[model samples]
Target chain A: MNTETIQSAIHPNQNHPNRNRPPLCFVRHAVWPPPRWGIALETPPGVGMKNWSNEFIGVDWGTTNLRAYRIGCDGGIQESFEDVLGVSAVSDGNFAGIVRELRETLGNLPMLLSGMIGSSIGWRTTPYVAAPASLEDIAAKITWVEPRWTGLLPGISVLTNSRADVMRGEEVQLLGYQSEHGLTQYTICHPGTHTKWAKVRGGKVEDFRSVMTGEQFSLLKEHSLLKAMMHGRVEPDRSFLEAVETGWSGVELTAELFTVRANVLLSRLPECRAASTVSGLLIGMDLRTGLRLAGHDLIVVLGDPALVRLYTAAIEHIGKDCEPAEGATAFVAGMTRIKEMIQ
Target chain B: MNTETIQSAIHPNQNHPNRNRPPLCFVRHAVWPPPRWGIALETPPGVGMKNWSNEFIGVDWGTTNLRAYRIGCDGGIQESFEDVLGVSAVSDGNFAGIVRELRETLGNLPMLLSGMIGSSIGWRTTPYVAAPASLEDIAAKITWVEPRWTGLLPGISVLTNSRADVMRGEEVQLLGYQSEHGLTQYTICHPGTHTKWAKVRGGKVEDFRSVMTGEQFSLLKEHSLLKAMMHGRVEPDRSFLEAVETGWSGVELTAELFTVRANVLLSRLPECRAASTVSGLLIGMDLRTGLRLAGHDLIVVLGDPALVRLYTAAIEHIGKDCEPAEGATAFVAGMTRIKEMIQ
Candidate 1:
């Protein structure tokens, strides 16, 4: 196989003639097989490439959902599958059986799993690679299951005198972003249940911070008194932008959170706008801390497009630069890199 | 009845010869009918006092619990009753029936209700009296129920150019504290589900702020991922104090909250200490905002003794002087003042 061809295909933008152009924005199309940003896998030109046998299955098994990708020998996604059978859903501890089913359905390819699947509650307990961790550091520490072919990627941890933060699956995406952009210094904001704000320096994760923004938003919207007012979709409306400003203003968050209820009681805010207002507040405060830890002018927001849009709006509102990237694409790129390393 | 006698009985500290002595500290004894702080009621000296027919029952119906006090003609608590029948427990909206049962169990005294009992979900929808409101303003706005003898006190609201805050039952406690201490200027911190921090000036509520600290703590401890590590009672140990300092240091609270779980995972903190650490972080952030809104040197913390102790510790840790007051005592005093006004 031609190593240069695989590298060029995986990071299309790096070798693109128009590399100086502004970064591409990834928008999700309504139909399946949507066009990718800059990745377009071309058939290799030689017999050795056709005979390549390094195909693999990448699985992101989180708490609520599982996503699987089938990577071709040329390091491009051939097909994908999704299911709600995440790590937490395996109540009977039949993770082996679940993976067996996946292997049967998605071809008998070797498996690489990430996320809570490697935690104590999942299939096995994998140790973490402390920061400053690089893609090579993570690739070297992969823990193999009983089956020699199945490997679990180690998560990353940052322990200091003042803070402790950990991320299981996002490290792969960070590495993918680093490989794709070829930038040694920047910040990446991976927004999710535990949103992580990581600073990358010299092509390695120097340190990072995690905020329970999404979790707090869910808890308040579903269980607290604010639930009654938190109806309707969270749009980036005026109420949301105004709340974003309030959240970013460094007000005491716990105190400011009560305004979501008080404003409704006083009829100053419509009930329908409560959800977006709360979303803005959480994301704004998230950026408030994230921007400080970022230590960079430009932020690369990697996540679902819907959430990325909100973060993009908030980041821009806070007078910072940000680019959106799809999480799946980054995940695939990251897995391919690790797969190459293992081979 | 001799009015001076009733006034002297209620304001025991004010009339005490050694009033210059430091304020008495109220500690809960293990036994029932624990010793009172400064109140020592004396029977009125006139025949009119014996026939004073102005006895009333004060009901504080909240979301999770109900507390009722029977006020004698001398404005002291003659008897008290408690039940889990808060307003939220009444699924059928039989508030009148509930009040009828209360009157039947206790005597057929005219009933005066406070707290969520006056909310929209309660028996009646009493309008809010805007601050700067005093006891007289709230008393004049009380909404009577179907029975002329039953009345619901109005809550207080602060709708300013920048913020909106509302309080139901806590208003009574603020008024009660003022009536007891006669402080023309002070700050009151009523710690509970939605802790209220109010500023009183010239014997009226100037403005206030509310923090969802208690509710957030409950939600995180019971529903979030932190619940797994949040075992054991939240004591005021070293872990709790250190967390309070972190919380009060103007750190991003949502980010700092995640440390509760990370610390335990990294072995820097034990699982049992998670609850107290979280408690400290929340209360520390609570004081961070409450102290700024207080605008006074000494803050009067009024609530259950246990919660009050936590807030007092946090307030002192923030380098502020604070005094602890019983919430029930303040409620009873406020109700007595309202009853006297209505009479």
Candidate 2:
């Protein structure tokens, strides 16, 4: 098999020839030729799909990319693969075909899918379960795609008071942490394009708020007038901390945003540090409002390590305590618990 | 000038063949062949430039456009001309050549120029007069480009409490209104790409805040995810009013913005009204912050009539009082006062 085929299974985002490939999953016995599917494979010289026999597959299918895992009966992760053919990339509703192809490659093992794959735009339209729901309630609502595979359409949590708010995929991640660790109540901050702060209580996600911090940062960095000064390279921590403090101090954001340009003009700030300041500003605003809604000083920050580190620094800088949770691991753990509940 | 030349003098943005043309201000006795500049003049049959004699020239030379006026000694506007060749369109520091050309054609009676033509990027760099200064102080700061033509380089006002904000071009308009009306204290709202709320004391601009509301709206409408829903057509008044009230009610703007999308998804709001809602939301935020900073309930709304109307509605909706001032008239009045001061 070409290294590309192997790598396609390794780093999905690097290549995806088409978005309409059929679902194909397998524990291969040998390095096989690159399969004719949408996934563009590029396995590094030393890495290839592992030869693992017979295990139930767990999948995290999202909007831009997806990862699949082979899980042993004891819940050990046996093998894994990735592809960039996300729901957004899929064309003409050919998801069933992609799934079939994945089954052909993986030997038709039973499978479980989560994330946006179960949303209105995915393989099947799955209704969102309301908040104050348990893991049992969430798993009970899984949409069965076929006899062998089921899609775990996640629940949506709503906050009626202090303004209307809602969340979808994050509910699964929250349940994952709760089910694996046996915890009841806590606040978790998931940082991404749309960051969410969830308040969990009595083994259920009670309320949540989605802040457009990450999205706003991206817009300002890449598209706004801030883009000019943002390109300068500088260490992000100091500027980020300063901006966080400024934002946390309750300055009006719209008025404060002009300072990004004014500081550069006045030479009080260097150009390279503008982006970090913007990041801190947005994050700080989110945290300020989030903390108000959270009603506590301690928060569980959940996401990838890179994002988690930033939040940890910001939270600690604000004089608050926080615990970090890795998102991928949490996703798998949540999937295993839900699979068990479904069976 | 040919009808095209006459119309070009009449409608500046319609044609400008060259940017380096002079400050030629004249009330032509008859329609001459279209004066060759960048504008390809094709004035429809009916329109032409008026002929008058011995009038002082008033010019508003901004970043993207220029307007030249012939005014009688009594401050009566005799004839006016326009062109798209503002300071930005001037190539290779040709300001002198442009002025020379205008002198050649219009026979250079005393001329007064204002706007960016006096800033660092314009014809000549002029120092900004500090704030809390009187109209005579501002008028005295006019930069004389030649024996016959003087450029008014306005000053920047500083706000020490919340943040630092500065404005150009609008200062002249502010002074114009103050000069004509003899006002001592008031707040003026200048609405445009970057809306300004300036606090005036004893005919001097004391403090001002530059809110990026208009810039932010354009970004959200043209670049943000909100663009898709904003394309629908609807009467803007209702949605604008509703959004303004929502913002004035102390709803956090960042969190409240996402409702523009959510409402469409939930069928709670019609898509056509999205733009109005966005306008109201942004204006409301500005008014809330501006009114607070103004430290008064009464404000003079000065800008183009369309923009002024919106701000007026928003202000009145919040139970505040406002007076509308036409931007062009105020600009001319301010120029007349400055010209008298300089001479």
The clash count of every prediction, one per candidate, is: 0, 43
Among the numbered candidates, top lDDT falls to: 1
Model 2 chain B worst lDDT window (10 residues): B43-52
TM-score of chain B of each: 0.84, 0.78
User: Model 1, A108-195: lDDT tens per residue?
Assistant: 6678899999998899989999999988888899898844478899999999887788888888888788787788888999998889
Model 1 ranges off by over 4 Å: A1-53, B1-53
TM (chain A) per model: 0.84, 0.81
Q: Write the residue-wise lDDT of candidate 1 on B145-215 in tens digits.
A: 73447889999999998899899988988978989888888899999999999999877899999999999
| Alpha-carbon deviation at B103 in model 1, angstroms | 1.0
Residue by residue across B38-141, what tens digits does model 2's lDDT show? 22323211212211133456777777677766566566665566666678677566776665545434434567777778766788866666677666877677
Give each model's whole-structure lDDT.
0.78, 0.69
Any runs in candidate 2 off by more than 4 Å, and if so which? A1-3, A6-125, A143-162, A232-236, B1-127, B134-162, B232-236
Best by TM-score: 1
Q: Per-residue error at A206 for model 1, in Å?
A: 1.7
Q: How does model 2 score on DockQ? A: 0.40
